[model samples]
Target chain A: MSEILKMAWRNIWRNRRRTLITASSVLFAVFFAIVMRSMQLGTYSNMTANVVGAYTGYAQVQAQGYWDDKTLDNSLDWTPQAEQAVLAHPRVVGLVPRFDSFALAASDSSSKGVGVVGVLPATEDSMSRLSDKLLEGRLPAPTAAEVLVAERLAVFLKIGLGDTLALIGMGYQGISAVGEYPVVGIVRLPSPQLNASLVYTSLENAQELFAAEGRLTSVVLTLDDPDFAEPTCAELAASLPEGLVALPWQELMPELVQQIESDQASGFLILGILYVIVGFGIFGTLLMMLAERRREMGVMMAVGMGRRALATMVGAEMVLLGTLGTLAGMAAAFPMVLYLHHNPILLEGEMAQAMLNLGVEPIVPFALEPGFFVWQGLLVAALVAVASLHPLLSILKLNVINALRA
Target chain B: MNVIEIENLSKEYQTPAAKVRAVDGVSLRFERGEFAAIVGPSGSGKTTLLNLLGGLDQATAGSIRIAGTDLASLRPGQLIDFRKDNIGFVFQSYNLIPVLTALENVEFVMQLQGRPKAERRARAVELLEAVGLGERLDSRPGQLSGGQQQRVAVARALASKPQFVLADEPTANLDSRSALTLLEIMERLNREEGATFIFSTHDPRVVAKARRVIWLEDGKVVSDKTQEPTI
Candidate 1:
């Protein structure tokens, strides 16, 4: 067996140029696969981090079934002890206590239905980067009777900074939730849905207006990694009160999961097509060697070499090729992919806006995990092994006399 | 004692034109330490007969017994092993494995016969030196001259210490001088090692060196003559 392996090794180098060509085919395959897969996964990473990171904060702790029928009446009983206990988990970085409900806002010129979010300004700033998204005017002071209106909503009501707007909504139970609040700032929201109908105010101000103090619609927690959200959320929920539930970003935003799944399906389809081409390329080289070396095969067989041994030698040759190519490709591609992972290519102008609209960073970040190299290497090795079967069968069925004459 | 015994051996091939009987019914026997030659025309079955005797091809009819073992009694894998242990082949093209050094080419059959590495290595070196390729043990086939490669093939053929060596027009591609040198080495090995040798050749130089000659015309032996070999 070792003799066969040694022969196989020497056999490939007997035709150095041809062997190099065959190995190069696998090399390019693995290299391109790594690059393509990395970019695709990187874009998904950016998308997940952007959409879930900035706003939803990976996971959310809300009243049970609140996501289905969101209203001020179905709010979590907020207590400092409960909040602190939930935030004590190692994975949890911070929490933003929020009061979210719908309210009708009216100015002298117009009236519109808006999503009114009541938040601790500093807590909201840490979680969703609300302050960074301010288009004009200062963030409203905590406990101040001030409002931050979405730019589009402010435009619809023709309300500018310092303009007083009347807000009316049904508060907890059947109470009339109405107040006249001054719009202190205009802010921009990334999503069109949010930009058109969002309003922000201090938690203290919202509780007084709704006649419900020390209460929260939900508590959105930010974690070290969005991917950890589900497991963390699971443990957090089990440890929390009976009426509350924790929702991971995947559950909180199923559309994003669907989008990622669809994209991955398409990516794999493309990679499958590439592997077919590479497999055939390796097989073609084998065919050429077989065609040219029919007599050599016969000679070996005639000199007491068995069909199985010859076939194994050929198979070993291919394995050697795949091994060489995989190593070379990975060695060549790793640093480049790693560089791109760190210093990503940032898209701009309409492309940047388009990416932003999809809730992902404009920069393309590659997923440079070790699995990328390992799986790609395995795939190419599998292709080489499968491709070797063609020649193996041919050799096994070889007619010694015919092969000799040929 | 007879090392090889054959009775009515035949091989038929179905070409597009018609069935061609390449080796017809013939009976022959060969003994140990004998250097024999089968001389025939292009269409005759000299090469085919050699292939059959070496277990490389199947005979259409009849049977061959070599060193008391029936050819038909062995399975495919066993036949391969039997061939490795009993029959050595030297082809017309000096078909040394281009990838292996001359020593490796010689050692290969012994290795297949499961000889110990050190034993095979020592035997391979001795045989290579006997064939006059002692200084070229590390040279691959591509680096050797035609005669040197053929010498390596001869060394390889004897490496297994087989019951007999079969040479199919082994001197066909060599120049007269290389052919004479190759035949001298083969003849010396046959005499000193008591190794039986059988050759299929049209080369008169080879035919002249054989101690016995069989003439075949159109796949049937017309004459079998024993003569004293002239050194």
Candidate 2:
């Protein structure tokens, strides 16, 4: 066995140029595959951070029909038991309980429809970092009769800080939800749509105005690890009161998930095409190896070396080359991935604008995880192993007499 | 003292026109410790007989018994093992494994036989030394002279301690000096170690060194005679 391995190893280096060329294909495969996949995943990561960071958090608990119908009747009471139930999980980092409803915002001479969100002052401030986004004035006090309007919504209503804004809409059921409060703050949001339509105020003031006191439309949870969001959401949903469904950001914003999934599918397709090309490259090299060593193979077999042994030696050579090449590729791609991870490539021009318009951060980053690299390496190695079937077929039917003659 | 016995051995090859009988109903026997040569023309069955004796190609009709073990009864895989343990082959091209050092090439068959490392190494060194390649043990075949490479092949053939060695035009690719040196080493092994040698050749030098010469013509041994070596 050692003899065979020594022979197989030395045999690969006999034609250094050919071996290097063959291995270069594998190297290129691993490099491009890992980098491409990293880019795709990293872009999704950035987009997830961008979108989720803006408002959705990682998971949300809302009334059963509230997602389909954003009316106040479907809202849940902000009971202490409900808040404690969600915060019980060790993974929970922050929470924002909110009551959101849409109403007409009328100033003295201007009127526009806007999304009104009532939030617990401190928790919303920490989860959404709402105060840091304030363009003017402080966050509205939780119990104060003041509202935080989005810049665009304030612009449309022709109202500024200290100006009164009226909100009129149907509350819980059949009750007229109406109020007029002074705009204490103007906040600039990341999403243009939200900036144009959102109105944030204290939970007390919102419940008072809506005639639905102590009720919350949603409780957004920020987790320590976002990857655990779905499972946590499941556990939370199972334990929560009826008429409440815990939804991860994926379910809450399925369009984003669909977009990332489509990108991932295409990314894998591109990788599949790369593997085929590399497979052919490997096949070509092995064909040349068999062609060049036809007589040697014949002589070995003619001397009573079994078909199995010869084929194993040939296969071992491919594996050695592939292992070396992919490992080298992993080594080579590591720094590039690490660099891209730290200094992400920023999107420019229309691409940046488009990404921004879609509420995603405009950058292409690389995910530099060891698992991704190891998985890609194993995949290439497996492809090389499978490609060795070519040699097995050729050797099984090898005519020692004919080969010797050749 | 017969190490190999054959009865009506035959081999046929299919052609586009008709079937060609490569070895046709030839009967012969090789004695232990005998240095014999099968001499023939280009189209004669000398190589085919050697292939049959070595269990390389299946016989079309008849049986070959090597040391009382019937070649016909052994399966293909079993034949390979039997050949590995009993028959050593030296090809015309001095077919040393180019990737391995001469010593490793010699050790390859012994390794296949699952010999211990110390025994394989000692036997390989002893064989190479006996073949006048003691100083070039570590050299690769590519780095050796044609004569030296053939000597390594000889050592590799005998590494498994086969009962007999089969050579198919073993001296065909060597110059007169290298060929003579190789023949001398093989003759010495036959004389001193009592190793049986049977090779096919058209070369007169090889025919002259053999203690017995079998003249094969058109797949039949027309003349089989024993003669004293001229040298």
Candidate 3:
């Protein structure tokens, strides 16, 4: 085996140009797969951070039947005891109670349906980065009845800071209710859907407008360890009162998980195509090499080398080439992926807004997971190994006398 | 003791046009330490007879026994092992692997026999030096002249110190001077080292130097002659 390996190594280097061309193809394929996968994963991470962490926190606690029905009757009573129980968990970093309702806002001839979230001013300030996201005016006062609307919604309404807007919706008892509140601030969210239709107000004003005192839609919880969210939520669910349930952020925004999974699956398909192209490139070069070394193979066989030994030598050459190429590709991809992970490429123009509307961040970053790189490297090695079987099988059928003649 | 025994050996190759009988109803024997030659024209089955005797090709209907073992009865893997262990081959084309240096090429057979590196290297160097290729040990076959390359092939065949060596027109590609030199070296080895040498060739010089000659024509042995007893 050692002799065969040594001979195989020397044979590969005999034609330096051919070896290099084949190796480079494999390297480029591996590099492309790694970088593309990293970027796709990074984009997904960024989207999850922007949409989940910035808005919904990592997990939420709601009334047992709230998510399915989402009616005013299913709202939880925000009791001090329940709040203290949730907040005292070791993993819980912050918690905020929210009151949510659907309403219509009309300004002049334009009207739009909006999701209105009523939050405590001090709690919202501490739990979310919404205050920093404000583009105009100031955060509404804790005791005031003023509201904050998204910048895009404000534009469509032709409304500015300090402008009075009429909000009309069904109140807690299912009665038709109306309120006049001033738009105290305008904010921008990364998601176009949220930016176009979301409005925020104080908890007191929400209770007054909706006639729903002490009723809250959900309680959002942030965790110091994002990955612990699901398990912690499960634990909370087990310990919570019979009428309450805990839901992770992924369950709240299932589309995000589905999109990421589908994107990765499609990316893998693309990577497979890339490997095919690289395989063909390497196979072509190897075939040419085998053709050129016909006499050499014949000589070895004529000199008492068994057919299996010759095939083994050929296979060993391919494995060596694959290993080196994969290593080179990894070396190149590491820094490239790392650089992109930190500094993502931001999309602009209509496409940017279009992506934002779909709840994806405009910037596409690169991410690295140890498993992803290992799988990619193994995939490349396996492709090369498969490609090498051609020469191995051919050598078995090779006629020693004919090869000698050649 | 007879090293190679052939009994009613016949070899036939199937071609698209017809079945070509390369060796028909041939029987011969080679004793240990004997230098013999099988001389014939092209397509006269001399090489075919050598192939059968060396266990490289099977006889269509015959038996071949080398050193008391029936070559025809061995399995495929056993045949390969038999060839590697007991038989050595020297082709007209020298057949040295181009990528291997002369020393490495000679060491290849020993490596196959599972010989240690140190011993294989020592034997390879000794054989190469005996063949006057000591200085050219590191040079590849492509770098050597036809004669030097053939010398390396001879060294490689003898590297494993097999029981018998088969040479099929070993001098066919060389000039007269190199041919004589190669034959002389092989003849001397046969005499001094007790190694059996068999040649299948039409080269008159090679035939003249053989102690025994089997003459074949049209796939049949026409004459079996032992040279006039030398004084």
Candidate 4:
């Protein structure tokens, strides 16, 4: 076996130019695959951070029909027992209980419909970092009769700090939910959809206004690790009280998941085409190699070398080529990705504007997921193996007498 | 005792035009330690006959019993092993593995036979010395001259200690001097090692040195005779 391997190694280098060209195809395939996949995943990562991380928590516990209806009647009952049941899971580190409803906000002559979210000030700050996004004044106190209006909503209403804002809507069980309060702060939100008509107040004020005391529209959970969100949500939902479902952000924001999936599918299609091209390149090189070495192979077999052994030697050569290209590609791609990940490439012009409109940052960061390295390497190796089958078939079907004559 | 017994050997090829018989029915026998040459004209089936005897080609209709083992009865893998153990071949082109050095090429067959490394190396060295290539042990086939490459091929063929060695027009590609040198080495090895040697050749010089010569014309044996070899 060692002798065979030695021969195989020497055989590949017999035609140095051809070997390098074939190996180069695999190298570039892996390199482009890694870089492209990293960029795409990084962009998706940024979007996930902006949307799921900042707006929706990793997972949420809500009444079964709440996501579909989002009405006050679909809200869950908030009690010590319910909160304890949610917090019992180890992954669930913190929860921000919210009373979410739509209402008409009017400042003097101006009026607009808005999403009113009543949150526990401290927990909401911890999970959503709402205080970090405060554009003016401060967050509303838990018992204060003041509200925080989104920057865009404040602009639309022509309202500012200490301005009187009136809210009117149907409350729980057909009661007229109406209140007026001072706007204490203006908050900037990342999502344009969320920023357009958002009003935040203390949970107590919301429950009081709605006449639905001790009720919550949802409790957004902050997890220790966001990657485990789906499994944790599944476990939480299985154990939660009837009529309540724990939902991961994927389910909470399915359009984002669908978009990522479609983009990923397209990315894989490009990668598949790349492998096919590289496969043919390798096959072409092997075909030439085999055609030139036909008589040598015949002589070897005529002198007692088995077809199986010759095939193994050829197989080993291709494996070496694949490994060489994969390693070199990873070596070339890793540090580049690492540098870009640390210092992301910021977008400009229409690309930046497009990103901003999508509520995402205008920078692209490479994802250094080890899976990218392993998967790309294995894929190229498998491609090399698949390409080798053509030559192996030729060898198996070789006619020693004819080859020797050739 | 007969080392190779062929009874009614025949080989045919189907062309787009018609069935062409490359080797018509021919019966022959070869004894151990004999220096024999199968002489024929072009397309007279000399090479095909050698290929069939070496297990490199299958006969259309025949039974070839080498050392009492019927060649037709072995499976493909078994035939390969049988060839590894029993047959050695030298092609006219000095078809040494270009990647291997002279010494490594000689050791290659023994390695396939799963001989110990030390023994394979030692025997390869001895064979190279016997073939007067002891000094060029490390030289690759490309680095060697035409005469030197055939010497390496001869050394490689004898390295396996096979029942017989088959040389197909071994002198065809060499100049007269190189051919004469290669024939001298082969004749000496046949005499000293008692290794059976069979050649398919049109060279009269090869026929002159053969202890026995079998002549073929149009795929049929015209004559078989044992004669005293010329020095």
Candidate 5:
């Protein structure tokens, strides 16, 4: 085997130009696949983390039919028991009970429909990262009948901190309710869709305005490990009483998950085509090499080399070429992909607005998982191995006399 | 004992137009340690006979026995083993692997037989020195002259110490002086090493150096002669 390997190594270097050409194809294919996959995975992770962390946390628990109806009638009663049940889970780092209802809010001469989320100020501060997105003023005090409106919503209503706003909407018992509250803060959400129609208030003020003294829409749980969210959610669902459901981020934002999965599939398809091109490039080079060495093969056979040994030597040559190309490509691509993973690329202009409208954050980040790297390397190696089969089969049935004549 | 025996060996190649018989019903025997030459004009079946005897081309009829084993009766793998163990071949064009150095080319056969590195290296060096190519051992085939390349081929042929070495017009590509030198080296190795040497050639210089000569015309051995050394 060592003798065969030495001969194979020599054969590769003998035709320096051909070997380099073959290697370059493998290198370029692997590099392109790694970089493209990294970018796609990065964008997906960034969108999920930023969107979920900024607002929904990793998981949410709502009344079983709340997501489907979203009406005040389906609202879960906000009780101490529900909060305790959610907080008992090991993965639940923080829990916030929210009373969410829609209202027609107006400031002096301007009016708009908005989603009002009534949250416990201190609990929300610890559970969601919304407090950090505040552009002006502060969160309402625990006992104050004050509200926090998104910047875009505030601008549309022409209201500021300390200004009075009227909330007019249907409350529990199918009755219209009206109340007046002061705007305590204005905040900007990462997504434009959220920023344009969201409003926040203290849980007490929400209960008073909606005439629902102890009712709640859902309890949102922030988990320590987002990747285990599905299993944690399943456990929560099992532990909870009937009429309640635990939802992971993926289930909550199914459009986002489907979009990412489709993008990943398309990315791999493109990479597969690139690998086929690389395979053919290597095949062409090996074919030319075999053609040139026909006489040499004949001589080796005449001197007692078996056809199998000759084919084995050629296969070894391809393996060496493939290994070098893959290593070089990985060495060059790993650092670039890792850099992108750490320092995300921010989207701006119309693209940024479009992404924000779709509930995705403006920045795209990469994931530097070892699985992606290993997959790319194996793809290159497999392509080379497949390409080598052509020459190996040809040599197996080679005729020494005809080869010599040629 | 006869080193090589042939009985009614014939080979036919199929063409699009007609069937061509390269060798037809030829019977011959060569004694151990004999330096014999098969002389023929172009297309006279000299190379075909050599190919059949070396187990390189299968004969269409009859059988060939070398060193008491029938070549026609062996399987594909067994034929390869037989060639590796018993037969060595030199070519007219000095078909050395272009990528290999002179020494590596010479050591190739022994490597095929799984010989140890040190032993193969020592034997390769000795053979190269014997062929007067000691100074060119490290040079690739492309770097050597025609005659030097042929000497490397000769050394490679003899490296495995086979019972018989077949030379198919081994000096056809060399100038007269280089041809004489190559023939002299082969003749000396045949005498000193007691290795049987067989040549298929149209070259008179090679024919003159043979201890026995077989002449072929139209795929049949027409004349057989044994020459006495004048010296």
Candidate 6:
């Protein structure tokens, strides 16, 4: 076996140019797979961070029917004990309770329907970083009749800072609700749909105006690890009071999940095509090598080498080539991918603006996790192994007399 | 004692035009330590006969016994093993493995036979030295001259210490000087090691060196005779 291996090693170098070219094919395959897959996953990761971090915290807890009906009638009771019960779980790092309802707002001659959300200013700022998004003024004060209107909403109502805006809506139990509040700030919400008609005010003021004190439409939980969101949601669902259910961000924002999955399927299609191309390249090399050495193989067999032994030598040659190329590719790609992971490519001009309008960051990041590196390496190795089978079977079925004559 | 016995050996090839019998109704026997040559024109079955005797090809309708073991009775794998242990082959093209050094080429068959590393290495060196390639042990076939490569092939054939060595047009590709040198070395090895040798050739130089010669015409032996070797 050692002699066979030594011969195989020497044989590959007999045609150094061919060996290197074949190996480079595998190298390019692994390099492209790693880089392409990293960029795709990294983009999705950034999008999820933006959407979940800015809007739906990693998971949410709401009254069982609140997500479906979304009315004051289905609001969950928000007491000190309820807050403590949620915060006691180790995975739940922070909780922000929100009283959400719809109302009609008007400033002079302009009127539009809007989603009115009341939040504890400090917790909302910590979870959603709402203050960072403020285009003007400050957060609405807890006890004052102040509000932050979304940028688009502010434009539609033609309302500016310190200007009073009138709101009217149905409160809990079908009671009539009305309020007049000063616009404290204009916040830029990333999502175009949310930016169009959303308003923010203090929980105390919203409950007072809606006549639903101590009731919150949902409690968004900031988790320590987003990857564990599903398990945490399961535990929260089981432990929370009756009529409350925990929902992971996937359920809260299914459109984002579907988008990632759909994009990922297309990415795999492209990757599969790349592998097929590399597979053919490797197979072509094997075919040429076999054709060139047919007579030498016949001589070896006539001198007493078995068919299986000859095949094993060729197999070893292919595997060695695969390993050499895979390692070289990884060595070349990892540093580049890691660099991109840290220093993402930021977009500019119209592309950046288009992404921002859709609430997505325009930077492209690469993921440097070792899982993908190892996976791409193994995939190329499998392709090489599969390509080598042709040579093995050809040798096994060889006609030594014909080969000798050739 | 007979090392090889054959009776009515025949081989047929089905070509598009017709079925051609390459070796037909040929009976031959070889004794231990004999240097014999089969001489025939092109298409007269000299190579086909050598191939059958070396177990490199199967006879269509005949029996071949090497050292009392019937060739027809051995399975394919067993025949391959038998060839490995008992028959050595030298080709017309000096078909030494191009990647291997001359010494490693010689050691290859012994290694396949699972000989100990030390024993095979020592034997390979001895054979290469006996073939007058003592100074070229590390030379790959590509680096060697035609005569040197054929010498390496001869050493490799004898590396397993097989019962006999079969040479199929072994000197056909060599110039007169290289061919004569190769024949001399083979003759000296056959005498010194008592290794039986059989050659299939149209080369009169090879016929001159053989102690016994057989002539084939149209796949049948036309004449057989024993004579004093010219060498």
Cα lDDT of all candidates, in order?
A: 0.88, 0.88, 0.85, 0.90, 0.87, 0.90
In order, the B-chain TM-scores come to 0.98, 0.98, 0.96, 0.98, 0.97, 0.98
* DockQ of all candidate complexes: 0.76, 0.71, 0.56, 0.87, 0.75, 0.78
| Model 6 alpha-carbon miss at residue A86, Å | 5.5
TM-score for each model = 0.93, 0.97, 0.90, 0.98, 0.92, 0.95
Which of the two candidates, 2 or 5, achieves a greater DockQ against the reference? 5
lDDT of 4 by residue, A1-406 (tens): 8888898899989999888888888889999999999999998988898889887878999999989988888999866777788899999988888888989999987999999999988888887789988999999998787899999999999999999999999899889999999999999887888888899999999999888898889989989999899999988876788888999999999999999999999999999999899999988888888889999998888888888889999889889888888888888899999999899999999998888778788899888899989999889878888899879988887887788877
What tens-digit string does per-residue lDDT give for candidate 1 at B49-134?
89889888899998999998989889988888898888888999998888889999999998888899999999999999999888
Residue B112, candidate 5: Cα error in Å is 1.3
- CAPRI verdict on model 5? medium
**What value does the lDDT take at residue B118 in candidate 2?**
97
Better of 4 and 5 by DockQ: 4
- The best candidate in terms of DockQ: 4
Cα error, candidate 2, residue A232 (Å): 1.6
Ranking by TM-score: 4, 2, 6, 1, 5, 3
Residue A382 lDDT (model 4) = 81
Relative to the unseen true structure, what is the Cα RMSD of model 3? 3.3
Instruction: Give iRMSD, candidate 2.
Output: 1.1
User: Ten consecutive residues with minimal summed lDDT in candidate 3 chain A?
Assistant: A296-305
What would the DockQ be for model 6? 0.78
lDDT of 2 by residue, A1-406 (tens): 6677888999999999989998998899999998998898888888888788668888998989988888888898767777778888788877888888888989998888888899887888887778878999989897888899998888888889899999998888769989989989999887889989999889988988888888889889888999898899988876777778889999988988998899899999999999999998988889889999999998888777888999989988888999988988888898999999999999999999888777777888888778898898789878987888877788988887788877
Q: Model 4, range B65-166, lDDT digits (tens) per residue?
A: 999999999998898899998888888889999999999999999999999999999999999998888999999999999899999999898998999999
**Candidate 2 lDDT by residue in tens digits, B83-165:** 88999999998988898889989988888888899999999999999999899998999899999999898888888878999
Give lDDT tens digits, candidate 3, residues A122-234: 78877677887889898888868899999899999999988887899998979776988999999987777788998899987887788898889998887888878889988
Report lDDT (Cα) of residue B60, candidate 1: 93
